[model samples]
Target: MENSRRSSLKLFFFVIIFILLAPQALSESDECAAEANNSCNNKARALKLKIIAIVSILMTSMIGVCLPLVTQSVPALSPERSLFVIVKAFASGIILATGFMHVLPDSFDMLSSACLKDNPWHKFPFTGFVAMLSAIVTLAIDSMATSLYAKKQSPGTSGHVVPEGDREMGVEVVSGGENNNFQFHGHHHGSVAVGKDDGSKLLRKRVIAMVLELGIIVHSVVIGLGLGASNNTCTIKGLVAALCFHQMFEGMGLGGCILQAEYKLVKKVVMAFFFSVTTPFGIALGIALSTTYRENSPRALITVGLLNASSAGLLIYMALVDLLAADFMGSKMQGSIKLQIKSLAAVLLGAGGMSLMAKWA
Candidate 1:
């Protein structure tokens, strides 16, 4: 158990060490220091901007995450509507673009940075290697968790009870939604109570939701930390804008997952709070460490690089395999040709928007 916990958590030590050991690497020449001093002429303005950034990002993140949760209060927004599937597809695209356009490229840049040793860094693609390994690791954990959950679930609790209306119609309405399409192989029989086995599917959604949040948290912290530690006000403005949008859309995607997880009220609130505050919290941590945190150091580069790679892999896999593929290839999507076309367009729009934002970041 101890070993397993350590294995699961070993990656976090990279960020911790990056934060703590960064001071020792402050060996930049006088020229570099001189440039930084020249550029940071308006400390007062930068401080105010950073403060605004914190408040702005926090509010936006809260709004984005809570937006989806608020739907539960409204009785009209059923998942059976095409709007729900389209929204989910759009959010999934944003997540996919974040991994491919933002995190993966950042990894490549940091790992292949000019500051690193060319002998190994240039000779091999460590970013790709680490990302691939992380993706495989995530898959292993996903499969293992599913099996374990399946075993522990009692037979009495093996499925959800069909609603009276659904029973009369010989169908389970709740299970037909794109987000709730937990059936395997995209197979569904019309007028059949497929959601009778929703207990196991709910377990799977819970696992995927938690896992998705894990990846998002790691990536958000890294981005926030770098932004907080930056001394350049000119670039900070653009990064802040990009990140605000980034966190908002990512929150929406995560919020959708939380909705599907069907947690208790307290659990739902707790999860939403964490997601809302993660990037801002990372920014605060970075602000506290700014004096000692040298973003360009070799050690910092390697650690952030590997961390980003791992995050990229996890996000990419979850976005594509668990979220996108599960929903797109599900019976819900397959049953509606018009919905599929609309959803594909939504995916492209979301991905395209995120990709455009990457240019600014």
Candidate 2:
């Protein structure tokens, strides 16, 4: 089941990448026509800064992502502890602010740019529309994936072997006959009892981790491209600082999810590598196509704007519904009022930090 989900996710990413790049490919021949005035005084200085940025951002991203993974051995950061919950809450907040404060506004700006024809651009709220549709699509995919996983885990349902949940639940049922059915009756007594099932929760976490990476990478590539194709030294300087912090904070969010997924050592390394390199990869692509890539061109604006809107929707839904809501309403938070307050504060801090960074980025 997990294998199938991963395959589908890969295909989904490929499709999105194609959609984003198709316009760039078509507009290459006419890039000079759509090019905005270059305001930078020193091309050499800008190139130096871009090189510095590439290295700095890459290192920061690696450190941020690997931090959580390496610290998983710490007792305080254990998955069941209160600290983990609080930290995850903060990460969720970062992701939430990323969608609302960063990507969404960028989409609005690009879509509303004066460079594009005023007719359709001003005729309707395409940013909001695309974002809304993306949210709905994310919800549908989330729920369907969960349902499918559960079904696949069922015994004798599809000729696939039953996983741990079914076998454990079955054992309890048969063992009940020998006893006075107390164990079986007690199992379903609480509202959140069923959610404690290890297999189901693990499955959910893995799904969330994979999906969150997809949403994040979409924006990461876009931002990289934006920075890479720009020749303005003044703009690139501020962008370098902003994106470094941006990638670091976003890395923490993704790292938290990856930790919760309980991936194997090899899988963890692979995921971390992917997250760390994506933006740099985008920067590289941007540099290679710098001459032919017009950032303000109509084709570039529309394609990137739509992709941002879609990614914003996906990230917002996943952060709010899957990450925040799920954990807040889970057994752990529900059992403690004080802890919930701390977690909420952590969330605000994370969101506030990201929101501040948005001003420059």
Candidate 3:
């Protein structure tokens, strides 16, 4: 456990050092000179567009994240419903596509940019290497955090977390001691067997959720940096629209994860707020440093590329192993062929929609 903590700390420390190592310069590149001129001519217009992008994207992000959370108030959208299962599967698929179709390719492009060195850069696959290390680090953190949180929980204490939808029914969460069953006591007595996991599974679910948020935050900052640093009004027009949809879809994915994580109101609010503001914060920073920061610069490319690669790995792993497999391989999903079929279709739809968006981005 101590080793795991050290690994997590080291990973973060390394990322900070890597970012600090970036070469800072304000000189514009020759290739970008023409775009820069065009942007200068339409400077006021481009600023207006960027401001619009920030405000609209922020609202869309908030709406997207809050959508699933609001479901806690709707009886029809209860977590136990097949619809919830399908939507979660769809959300997982969206995350999967984000890693595979979006982040991974972007990393490849940036690392392979002509601006980078020919010797070491071309000779090595830094993107894949960094991604692999990041996935391993994420796994370590996930395992360590879950185990620690589970240990901290009092085994003898009984806790009640009444979901909003079940409040009208006076529902109380009942942990099945040393068993895999989760009892929700309402007007009627019944057991919903949560299958093949001890009560610690709930703790694990909560702990693992923060990792998903971490990855999403990293991806958001990268996306925002690109849009913020670019002066090309033509690209910004299309990118702003694409990014709004991007945040909306990704927000749905994160929202679904948060919904299942069983966080308290305060924690949920904090997570959602951080997610809602990350991209905008990144965009603001980019705009402030637009004169000095070049997206295509060797240092900038390396930093963003590595960050994207790491995020891609974390998202891909969580979506596949933690989110999808954990849900699908459970007794309930495996036992129901109809549910499986429905979930697969939902996954396809979500993945296809996100993949299609990649074309414009």
Instruction: List lDDT for all candidates, in order.
Output: 0.75, 0.78, 0.76
Per-residue error for 28 in candidate 2, Å, reads 5.7
TM-score ranking from best to worst?
A: 2, 3, 1
RMSD of each: 7.4, 5.4, 5.8
Over 4 Å off in model 3, which ranges?
1-41, 155-198
- For model 2, the superposed segments whose C-alpha errors exceed 4 Å read 1-16, 19-41, 153-196
Model 1 lDDT per residue over 55-103, tens place: 9889888887877889866655445567877888899999999999999
TM-score of each prediction? 0.81, 0.84, 0.82
For residue 314, what is the lDDT in candidate 2? 97
Among all candidates shown, the one with the greatest lDDT:
2
Q: Provide the clashing-pair count of each candidate structure.
A: 0, 0, 0
Better of 1 and 2 by TM-score: 2
C-alpha lDDT of residue 146 in model 3: 74
Q: Encode model 3's per-residue lDDT on 1-361: one tens digit a residue.
A: 3333443454456435534543343334622222255434365677788899899999999998889999777877777778888888998898899999989999999898887788888889988998889899999989987766555443444432222233344443445675423444556566443332444666566666678888888888778877777777887888888889878878887887788777666667777887888788667767877778877767677778888999999999998888899889987799999999999999999899889988877
Clash-forming residue pairs, model 2: none
